[model samples]
Target: MELLNQFYANEKVKQTLVNFITDGRLPHAVLLEGEPGVGKNHFARLIAASSLCSGEKKPCGQCRNCRLVLQDTHPDVMLLSPDGADKPYSVHALRELILSCYVLPNDGDQKFYILRNVHEMSEQAQNTLLKIIEEPPPHVFFILTCQNHARILPTILSRVVTLTLWPCPVEICAQALKERNPDTDEEECLRLAKQSGGNIGRALSVLQDEHLSRIVKNAQEAAQLICDGKEFELLCLLNGYNRQKDDFLLFLGELRQIFVEALRQKYGASDKNFLPGAMLNRISALQTMRILDIIDKVSGEAAQNVSISLSGAHLCSALQQTLRG
Candidate 1:
């Protein structure tokens, strides 16, 4: 597939894979670990495509094999994911995958199995997988993708070639978004890229989420209310958000970003300051630090399944106390 070329970030990882594919020295088992939306799954597919492509250039996008892999209809490629609504791969499913691997390739000289969220596999399941990866058929290849590699067994780690994917620069991510959707404005792209914290998937998600603009406006309004020490108005404003847990978090996150942007502005480093200038001028460096501390504390508490209303109340009261001083 052309996905490797299109991968927005991690040039080192991309170059490493390109060398492996070009030299026909790709490992029998590969593990790709990265944050969510860092494109681990797409990178894995590109590796599989390179292995299965029939053209002189590995993964020539126009080749039949590349097309099959792109369309996810390749008989020789198996995608093993969480089955039976379980956190880990079932032992039965692991065994079936092992048995299936031994069968001859249906259409190519080699077969590829792409495992998603492989870290969720139980120790027993990984052990079963380890046995095959240790002594796999010459033509069989395995690609594993996960968010965390520490959870994987050491034995499994030792047997596989591991690669870490990092978030791309915002500029690269913005360029990618522009290429994919030419009509999106540069301002929106930069906003999403900045807010997403370099995650291409998240940047794209922000663009697609219709409620985001409303969320940002509400966050800015809420920030103003808190900073102005409007206690009753702040509570009432937060009341609108307290019913939905996700929306509450989203609101708080946007509010938190405004403080972050304020700190950036104080340092003369901010280009995308979303918070109003009047509010920004009111916040001193020390005040910004204090507010950030409050945000961190509230965020930690919220993670413990605290009620959204209580969290909102605490956040508003704390902001009042801090900003009023």
Candidate 2:
């Protein structure tokens, strides 16, 4: 429980995990699934620490095992992630990981393989992983994290214990932000909490990184333009990113999130204050869906190393046509 104390919200998940760990019934293969900023990585680490901690209270935070895991220096904990800009795990690398599963733990009775973003793995790479996870060595455990479970193979899903994480309430997230950053004003913290839809990691990034803040601002502005059906203005605004492909991609991601929030609001989900109520009211659910589709297309083109200027033009025209139609 102490290990998970820092992880806010999700009381049920915390208690469920606590019971499993206390009863020594923790699954050998665990899958943590959630949105990008929902703390899947944090939860994964907590589980790892709890399993390997030497002290009586699992993950006492003072024991050598716990400290090592916190510092990412634990010999028994291997953190794996996809490689390259496209973020695909190499089938060859995964095969090597499978081969290493049989090796005994170096520092403890058990070893943990923490694989981040397994959803990004190609089907071939996942199949390679399935070979080991299906019948992993008794001394080895696999902890996988992903933003989407739909991308994972059914066989993999059937083999792991899946836990889904969601954002905390806006007030709870704001209070957390205030506690972590005492120097920041309460109003600013609340604003960030609302803008990020209670996602602490997302709000914290905007607070700490000026570039990300700018990207977020640009994205919100773009969403407003889309709602207002301002094709020319939207084009002019997006044209500013012609030379900054990375920033443009980030903007697209933020824009997609805004539209998703708007769509949810249209369907009676509680507003996280991602946008002004007036703006949200202006866009219908169908229009939001169309915009999301267009954004996905543009994002795909951007990922393929397409010219940012060209993508921006296409996005503007497509959105305008969809909105008018």
Candidate 3:
């Protein structure tokens, strides 16, 4: 596939890879770790394309090599992602890759193997390929991608150069969305970009969430109702959200954003900035800080998934108190 235009944020990484390839000293094994959809796969493919391209500019993007890679038919290029990254890679798959590593490349310049979502490899699978990784064939190169670097085995981690990828800035993401879907409003796409928390995959995911629309709607209503001291209505909405335990924390996060935006407006931040308009000037700054503190606490606990039993009610009450103050 053509590298997504959204990958512009990763130009440094692409250049780094390009430099290494041009110098002919690129490591045999590499680990690409990042938030999902920040273009780990694209970076890997670009590097793979650069390695395979026989053109003067390497990845001239118009060569026979580039065309074959885009078609997923590069003779010396191999992709060995987990059967499903949401699941585990099998011992059989790892063994196959290991065996394939020993074979000479078909055209014989270099071999590129991409193992996407290496974190999903089972212990046995990781162990199966350790020997091959330890003594890789001279021309063989591996690119492993993962969302959670911690899930990968230390042995594997130690063996590869770990490349970290982060989400692109909102303006960049918005620019990209505008390029692909010209009809989409830039401001609206920026909102989605912020909600994505630095993951393009997540930004796209946010676009598809009916639940998010409801969550945003409910949070907006709760903010207005809380400001009006509509305790009963607020409690009803919170209680309804509390049932969908998995979504509660994210819901709280949205509430926190709205409240924080209101506070920013109180401090004279403008609408062009992301702060909510100054209608909430009555709420004190300290109250906003306290609600934010509670959000941080709840968000931390929620991330560990250990605090699921903790009621969002307490956080809601703190936000209510913040509004009331």
Candidate 4:
């Protein structure tokens, strides 16, 4: 992402940013909602840099403020996210930020406070944010990023201008990857972009790393185990996930891909296996619908910052429900 430019998929977002910079029509808060790895953070950083840059258009990418922003030393810009657990934005962090908002800017005409992954914000933090959005200082601008916009209180949503970011187009993702790393192979870039479903960051991740083939292989194996009625193998897979908790999402994604593949296989197979045990009876069409439902429900639950164990239990139940059709 070229900060000064290169935003794709939503013109309103660019227009919103434009309004803030040129016309000084800045909102107290703006909610940027989008899918994972879709460059929401990059957009947030660009907006912050634009706010701090003293040039006519601000984020000239050639100005001193731009340099400072690139160096991650911009005084007027503050970035905060959830702590150690990689989840839960505590009320404590928000409280500190809200207090700091009153101090005003140091080196520029405005102040930018970015709170990423705010879906994890504590209830108290959300309330505090509601107050800030409702009655913020003139030069202050808040950008809150979350995978699900609904996780923010309705009151908070009402107070701010909302900009929803969509995933970058696959072609755009390929172009970006090529620009970012000229050494990258075109075929691999296109493949990753397609596989990533418009999330260029994730596309890059999938493309650059060769180690994930093992994860994909394991996922395929797990899917076969489910189809084969191998309960012990399923247990082992779950245990393996528990041991390496950091890749929990990746593991879940893999399982989901397997489910999707199973659904796709229904197109050709005369008698497809949708799920194990109780779920083995569902029709292919019903199985597909159920898979979508499960994905949606699980994803919705994740936005609430629920525990993986609880989520997995629910997910397993959902799978059982789908197959029993």
Rank by lDDT, highest first.
Answer: 2, 1, 3, 4
The whole-model lDDT of each prediction reads 0.80, 0.88, 0.72, 0.69
Tens-digit lDDT track for model 4 on 1-325?
A: 2455666656677877877878766676888898777888878877777777667666777788887776767898877777646333566655666788889689977888888888887667789778777888888889889999878888888887788887666677778888887898887676666555556767667666666645655655755655555545565665565434446566667667556545644554412232342333334656656765775676566556666666666766666656554
TM values, all candidates? 0.75, 0.93, 0.69, 0.74
- Please tell me which predicted candidate would have the highest TM-score against the true structure: 2
Model 4 residue 7 lDDT? 66
Q: Which residue segments of model 4 deviate by more than 4 Å?
A: 84-89, 216-249, 257-285, 292-324
- For residues 153-208, what per-residue lDDT tens digits would candidate 3 score against the true structure? 88988898888887776677666666766787888788866555335665665666
Best by lDDT: 2
* Selected candidate, larger TM-score, 2 vs 3: 2
Q: What TM-score would candidate 3 get against the native?
A: 0.69
